[model samples]
Target: MRAIKDEHRAARHRRRRLSLAVGIPVAMAAAAGLTYGTAFGVFGEDAQPRASAATAAGAAAGAASAADDVADGMADDVADGFASVNALGQNGTYGGRDGKTVTVKTLADLEKYATAADPYVIVVAATITMDPKGKEIKVASDKTIVGSGTSGQIVGGGFFLGQGVHNVILRNLTIRDSYAGTWNDKEHDFDAVQMDGAHHVWIDHNDLRHMADGLIDSRKDTTYLTVSWNKLSDNNKTFGIGWTENTTADITIHHNWLRETEQRNPSTDNVAHAHLYNNYLQDVAGTDITSSYGNYSRGNTKMVLENSYFEGLNNPVTKDSSAAVVQRGNVFVGTSGRNESGGTAFDPKSFYAYTLDKAADVPAKVKAGTGPRAATGVTAEAASSTLTVAKDGSGRYRTVQAAVDAVPANNSSRVVVSIAPGTYRETVKIPANKPHVTLQGTGGSRKDTVIVYDNAAGTPKPDGSGTYGTSGSATVAAEADDFQARNLTLSNDFDEKANQNLAGHQAVALRTAADKAFLDGVIVEGDQDTLLLDTAAKDKLGRAYIRDSYVVGNTDFIFGRATAVVDRSVITLKKRWDGTSQGYVTAPSTPADRKGFLITNTTVTGDVSARSFYLGRNWHAGGDATLDPQTTVRDSALSGAIRTTPWSDMGGFPWKDDRFAEYKNTGAGSGTASGDRPQLTDAQARNQEIADWLGNWNPTALNPA
Candidate 1:
C-alpha cells in the first residue's frame, strides 16, 4: 500500500508539472486530478477480468480511484497553506528561540538582550524612552522580542536589523518618534526600523508612528520577511520594500494598518517578488505600492495584491511597462485612482494553491481576521462580562438614549452596550466627553434593532440652536472618539416626499463626528443627506469605517468631510415622489489636505428608473474650488438607474476639477463610452488603500469579533 501511494504521488507530480508547463490554470489542473493514478486503484489484487469488455471496465474504475486520490492530495495542500497563513515558506516564522525567558525593561537591558547570540524569549516589562539623537539598537539572531500587554514601548529611537541577522520575531511593542539625525536626507539616515540583508524575519502587532523619515525599510537581499498586524503612521516616507538597486527581496506584508502616511506604503523598487495581502490602507496621501524603477532600468518587480482595502487613497496600484502586478479581489472605496494604465501581467495562481475572496467580502473578512488580538480588542472583551440594555423595560434602561447616557464620561476602555430588538423613537447623542463606547444590537440584524426619528434640516431644536443645519439633523449622533455600533439601524423619517424643496430638504439619519468610529452590519436609512460623517474638532481629523451595512437615501445620501470608508455595503437610491429626477449619491466637503471618501466592494441599486441617478456632486463648503474633492467609487456594481453623467454641479461648482474616479467597476451603470466619467491611470491607483486614510489606526483592529 505504501509503494502504491508513493508511485501514484510521483505520477501525479509529473502530470501536474506537464499541465503547468502547458499554461493551464492550477484550478483546472486540480479539478482534473492531473489525469494521474486513476487506473491502478480500482482493480483489487485478486480480481481478474474474464473478457475484453470486463477488463476495460475494470481499468476505467481504477482510473477514477487514482484521480480521487490526486484530488485529495491537492485539497490537503490547500488546507496546509491556509493553516500556515503567517508561516515563512515551510519554516517556522517565529525565529529560533529556546523556552528560556528574559525580561527587559530599560534601554540598557534591551540592547544587552537583543544583541546576545543566545536563544531567548525576551519580554519587555516597561516602556523604554530614548533620545532622538541616540544611536540605533541592533537586534541579533535567534531571539524573540515581545511586549508585556500594551505597556511595553520603545520611544524616541529605533532599531536595526543589519547583516547576518536571521530568525528573529518582534511583536506587541510600540515604537514612536524615531527621528532621523537629519530630515529629508535618505542617503545619510535610516528608517525607524531598518532591515538590511536580513533573513527569516517576522514583525507583527507593533504600533509604529510619528517617525521623521521612513517608518520601515527593508533592502539589500532581505529574504523570507513577513510584516503583519502592525499599525504604522504619521511618517512622510512609510515602508520601503526595496532600496538597493539590482537587489532582489522576498517579502510578504499582510493585515497591516497604515494610516496618515504620505508615501511609499511599501514601495517596491527593483524587488523580485512581494506578496501583499489583506492590508487596510486609509487616508494615505501620496502614491501607494509604487513599482516604478525606470530611473535605473531595473528588473521587473512581481507583486501579488489581493484581499486588500483602500480608502481615501490617491493612487492604489502601479503597473508600469516593466513591472508585473497581479491584483485579485481588492476593495477600493472613495479612492480616486486605479490602474487605468495597464501594461504588465502576472498570475498569483502560479505560485500557490489558494482561493480568491470576492471583492465584496474582503472588507468584512479583513476587519474580522486581520491584525493581532490586542490591536482588535477582541481577546479581553471575550474573556470579560458585558452590560445589557432592553427597549421593552425588561433589563437596565428602557430606551437606547438612556442606556447611552449611563456610560461614564471620559471612558478610556471599551464599554459595550448590548441593546435588544425594538424601535426607539427618541433622539440619541454620544457626548464628546464619552469615548470608547460600543452600541451593539442583540437582535438578528440591523433591521430588528431600530432607532427612528422625524426631523429635517430645518427642524427646530429644544435648546434653540436655530434650525438644525444639514450637520445637525441626524436622528442618532456620535460625537466622541472610538465609537462603534453593530447590527443596528438609525433612520430619519422626515417625509421627504412632502418636503422636497421646502426646509432645505436634508434629513440626516446618522451623524458621526467620532475619530476611529467603526460600524459593522448596521443600517442608516433616509432621504437627502441621510448620513453625516464629519469631524467635531477643527484641529483634528475624524475617521469612520462602515462594513457589511446597508444605506438608502436620495440627494447626497452619504455626505461628509470626514475620511470615511464604506465597504461591502449597499447604497440604494430612492426615487423622488415628484418623479422629476434623482439626486446625487455623495456631497463631500473635505479639507484641502485630507482625503475624503471611499466606496469599495459595494453595489448601488434602487427604486429609480434607468439612467436617473448621479454618483456625486462637489460641495465647496471650505470655499476652495481649487482643492481636489477626493471621492472614489471603485470595485463596485451600479444599477442601470445610474445616469451616464454620473457627476453633477452643485451651487455653480462644476465637478470636473474634483478628484472623482471609477476603477474597473462592473454593472449596467458604469459605461465609459460617453467620456463623461473620469478614470485613473494604473500608476495612480497603485497608491490607494484604506491604510492611506486612517494612518496608525487599524480599522480592522477595532473589530470585536
Candidate 2:
C-alpha cells in the first residue's frame, strides 16, 4: 500500500508494544468523539505534524504538543501576512440592479441609469477624447456611463473611469488611455478614472485594459459602486488593480474579470466595502488584491466568485490573499508560482489530461507561506456563526479539514461541523466512506460567509505529474455520502489573472460522488467545470439537491451526469471579455435511463446581449448524450442576455430536440413556447419524471420532487 504517514506508522509500532504515550491520548480523544480515521500508532506513528502555529491575529489554534509543544513549528500568521476585515462585497450598498431606461452614446449621457432625476447615459466609441480639464467626465451626483459595446471606445486619462462624482454608472465600453496609435505626449497625470471623492457608482460592461496607471484608482472618500461585467486585463508594464488608502465604502466588483496584468494591488493602503463576484481572472502578475495596511472594516466583505476561471500566472507572492480571494468554481490550470517554493502548473488547452482511470501527470502542492500556501488555521469554535461544530478538550485541532479528517469511519452518530464567518482557504474532502458528515456555515445571513479555493485541474504535482485529475482537480471534492452544506460557498478560484489562462480550465468546484447530498444557500463557481455533480458511482439513484444558490460559468459548467434538482438557483452564463458569446447552460452527459437534471425557478443572466448565449446542448459524450430529453427548465426568468437557437451540437451529431426543454418562464431570454421546444404547462410541470424523480424532495420545493 502507499507508504503510511511516517509518524502514524511509528505510532502503530509503539501501540503494538502497548505503549500509552500516543495510544492513551488517542483513545481518550476518540472516546470523547475524536476518531482519527484509520487510527494511528501509539508512538512515533505520525510523521511530525505539519507546520502550524497560532499568533495574535484574529485566529488562534490549539493542538496537543508532542514535538516541543504545538507552538514551536506552528506559526500563527494567516496566509501571507494576511490581515483581517480589509475589503468587502459587490454592489456596495445599492439595494438592487440599476434599472435605467435610456440609450447612452457618450460619457455625458450616463445620468439616465441613476436613481436621480437627470440621469445620463455615457456612450463611447472607437476613441473618445477626455476633456483635459476633467470637465468631460464632469461633476455629477448621480450619473451612468453605458458604452454601446459596438459603437464606442473611450480613450485617454484626463477623465478615465472615476473622478469624485457620486452615484454614476460606467457601462458597456472599452475605457482606457488609448495610445493614439502612437504615445500621446499630451496624456498627463489624470487617472483613466479617479474616485476623488465619489460615492455610489456603477462601472459595468466596460473593457479597461493596457494602461500606464490603473483600471481603477479609488483611494479618496467613501466610494460606493458596483463594478460588474468589465474586463480588466493585460495591464502589463502597468498597474492592473489599485485601491489606494482611503475610506471607500461598499465597493462591489462583481461579474467583472481581471487577468494578465502587473502590479495588482487589491488592498493597497487601508480600504473597505469590497464585494467580488463571478469574473474570469487569468495570468494576474502582480500583488494579490487587497493590501494589509488598515482595518477600516465592517462585518466583512461579501466576496463572492462564481462561474469564472483563473487560468495561469507567473507571480507567486500569492495566487491571491488566502484571506481575500473568496474564489468559487473558477478553473486554475498549469498554475505556477513566482516564488522559489511550491505551486502547481498546467497547460491551458489540454484539460483532457486523462481517460478511463489512467494516471496522468500531477503538480506539486503549493508550498507553505506562498500564494494560498499561507492559511488561517482555526478550530471550529474559534469564531461565531450560524452553524456550530461541537468539539471538546479531547477533540482539539486547528483547521476545518483537520477536524473532518479526524472523524471515525462507520460511526453510529452523525457528525455536523459548523464554520464561523471568515474566508477559509483549505482544500477539504468528505471521504466516500465517511457518511453523516455535514458542513454548515455560521453567518447572520446566508450570503455573509464563505469557504473558498482556486485549484485548477492542470496544476503541477510535487512529483512532476500533471496535476489535473491526478490530484483530484477540485478545490472541494465530496466523495462521502449523506453530505449536506448550507449558507456557505465552496469555490475553486483558479482565477486566470493568477493562473493566466493556464489553469487547464476543467477545474471542478464541487465534485460530488455522494448519495442524497443536500446543498442549500450555497454558491458554486468557476469557469468550466464549476458545479461538477458527478455520480460516476455504481449506484443509479445518486441524488443531489441544490437550492437558493447561484451557479455561474463560461463553458460546460453544470456538467457531470449526476441526478440533480437545481431549484431557486441561478445557472448564469458567463460572458467573455472580447464581447464574444461567453457560453451556454447545461451539458449533461447522462447515460440513458438515469434522471439527469431539472432546473426550476431560476434565472439565466449574462454580461453580454441576448444573442450571445444558447440554452442546452449535446453534452460532448457523442450520441450517448442526447440533450437527454431528461433535463428541463421551468418557471424561471431567462434574461435578454441568452441566445435562443443552436442549443446543442457536437462534432457530428445534432442534439436540438434530444434533451433540453423549457416551460412557463418569462424574462429577457424567454421565448414563445414553440418549435424544437418542450415548454411544459403548469400541470405537466408538476407531474413528470422531472417532478417525481426526487421523491419527497420538493426541488420546486429542491425536485427532480
- List per-prediction Cα lDDT, in the order shown: 0.64, 0.47
Model 1 C-alpha lDDT per residue in residues 1-705, reported as the tens digit of each score:
010000111112212211012121224322322121111111111111112232233234433543453232210001112212333433434332332456788888888888887755577768898744435689888766777667777887677889868767776678787665444556535456788887777777678887766678877877667777678876767787666766466666776777776677777776666777777777733544332210111246767777777777666666546776767677777676544323353453454454545656655654554333342221222212233455533333456765565455676666666677898887889899978777776664456678899888787777887888777778989998888877777889898676656567788999999688887667788878988888886446999877766777878888878998776666767766576657888988777667788886666766566787888888877666654566777766676777787887776776776667776566777767234787655544444445556656765554322
Tens digits of lDDT, candidate 2, 600-640: 65556645545666666666554553334346776656666
Single out the weakest 10-residue window by summed lDDT for candidate 2. Answer: 76-85
**142 Cα displacement, candidate 2 (Å):** 56
What TM-score would every model get versus the actual structure? 0.45, 0.43
Lowest summed lDDT across 10 adjacent residues in model 1 is found at 1-10
